[model samples]
Target: MQIPFIDLKTQYETYKEEINKEVLNVLSSTQFIMGPQVTKLEENLAKYTGAKYAFACSSGTDSLLLALMAIDVQPGDEIITTPFTFIATAETIALLKAKPVFVDIDEATYNIDPKLIEAKITPKTKAIMPVSLYGQTADMDAINAIAKKHNLVVIEDACQSFGAEYKGKKSCNLSTIGCTSFFPSKPLGCYGDGGAVFCNDDALGAKLKSLLNHGQGKRYEHKYIGINGRLDALQAAILNVKMNHFEAECKKRIEVGSRYSKLLEGANVITPTIMSDRNSMYAQYSIRVKNREAMIQKLNDAGVPTAVHYPIPLHLQEALSYLGYKKGDFPISEQIGTEIMSLPMSPFLTESQQDFIVNAIKA
Candidate 1:
């Protein structure tokens, strides 16, 4: 049997009728951009995440951009972030003509290490953007304490962790400004590209709304310099339907992750670690293994598909070489880049399929 990674097809089939109706409604209205569906989704997202306000945008990357713009990130302004995450985490900071200061990650959690952040702070520091890697939030309490001491802003990159919880609070609402993606495979996703920024501050929420619409306070009136980052009505409509079942899906994901850990015990691999203080959505059940390439080949031959969350850390990527980082700069990130491999993980994955995959790994 061919086991697929991230089975969105099963989810689509489950909600076909509702999703189809919503899409058709948007098409009939011809309000493809910022339609009523977008407003409704934004409101629902805010309520779901416990944020006072939410602004839907074109993609997760743009959500980060909007957060930076609202926080007034200027040229040479430094935003402290992790190098082990997707490039978009650092790319957004650089796009605003600001610098992204790299921080090492915790080996077990794979999230930014709060202990290393204080050393990176400088007079030019503007914000701390910590990615909630693999659906688990970083050490937000420690990071927030550091940020508070420095009077710096905190942006939680919850793109991979939309429905996750940190210390009894939702991941996206754990910081000053939280951004998440609704890309097709995210914990909460739409049919296509979509994202949102959440904030408790009413003034900042208003600023984010203005920035999402080409910086417009009113129609044809441009305010702060912004980009066309509004979420399409069609995508919002899709997300609205998906949001209805998100909580149930999250519960299933936790079960899948827990089972994987139990089944893989004593196996020659390191399963992901979820802290007791927080619950993960288990966006990707990644593992660290020796002889990763050979293991990947074995899984492929067995028809159990796999993927790598990242093969290279951003600090070592050629694009950011000018940042002057070298091989040993972030040893943990560099090591994980070579060893980490993601197994097929989804709420829809069946017990039989999981057993097959695990048995193949042991082979």
Candidate 2:
């Protein structure tokens, strides 16, 4: 039997009729830009995430850029973030002509180690962006307290963690600004590229809205330089429909993740950890294993598909050569970069399929 890494087709099959109807409604209305659908989605996401404001944007990358723009990131300013994440997290900071200070990650959560954050702070530091990697919320309470002491902004890159929670608070609401993705495979996904930024601060929210739409405070009135980063009404409508089933999907993902952890117990793999204070949405069921490349080959030969979330940390990537980072700068991140591999994961994943994957790894 063959198994796909992320079976969006199964999920689509289950929600096809409703999704089609919603798409047809958008087509019929012909309000394809930021229309009623986008407004409704923004409202629903704000309520769901417990954030006072939400602005849907073009993509997860755009969400990070918009957050930086909302905060008026200045050139030569520094933003401290984890190196063990998608390049977008750090790339956005560099795009603004700001510096991205790389920090190591906790071996357990694959998140920025807050204990190491204070030493990295400087007068040039403007913000701290901690990514909620692999659908788990990072230690935001600690991160926030540190930011407060240093008087810095905190942006949560919740790209893979839409429904995740930490200490009774949701991921997006835990930071000064929270950004999430709706890429087709995320917990709350749409058909195409889409994302949102969440915040409780009103003035900042207003500025974010302005920054997303050519700096408009009113109709066609430009106030500052901005980019066209608006979310399409079609993606909004799809996300609204998906949001209707999001809670159920999250529950299913939890069940699948739990089973994987239990079955892989005491095997040659290090299971993903669910910290005592947080809940993960399990966007990708990644595990640390020895000889990850060989194991992937073994699993693939047995028809079990696998992937690596990231093979290279940003500090060591060619894109960030100017950062002056070498291979040994962030050892933990570099180690994780080599050992981590993602198994096939989705809310629609079946137990038999998981069993097959596990057995293949054992074999």
Q: Residues 51-81, candidate 2, lDDT per residue (tens digit)?
A: 9999999999999999999899999999999
TM-score of 2: 0.99
Which 10 successive residues of model 2 have the least lDDT summed? 354-363
Determine the backbone clash count of candidate 2: 0
Report the lDDT tens digits of candidate 1 across residue range 99-131.
Answer: 999999999999999999999999999999999
Instruction: Report model 1's TM-score to 2 decimal places.
Output: 0.99
* Candidate 2: residue 99 Cα off by (Å): 0.2
Model 1: residue 276 alpha-carbon error in angstroms: 0.5
List clashing residue pairs in candidate 1.
Answer: none
The C-alpha stretches of model 1 lying farther than 4 A from their native spots are: none
Full-model lDDT, candidate 2: 0.93
Clashing pairs in 2: none
lDDT of each: 0.94, 0.93
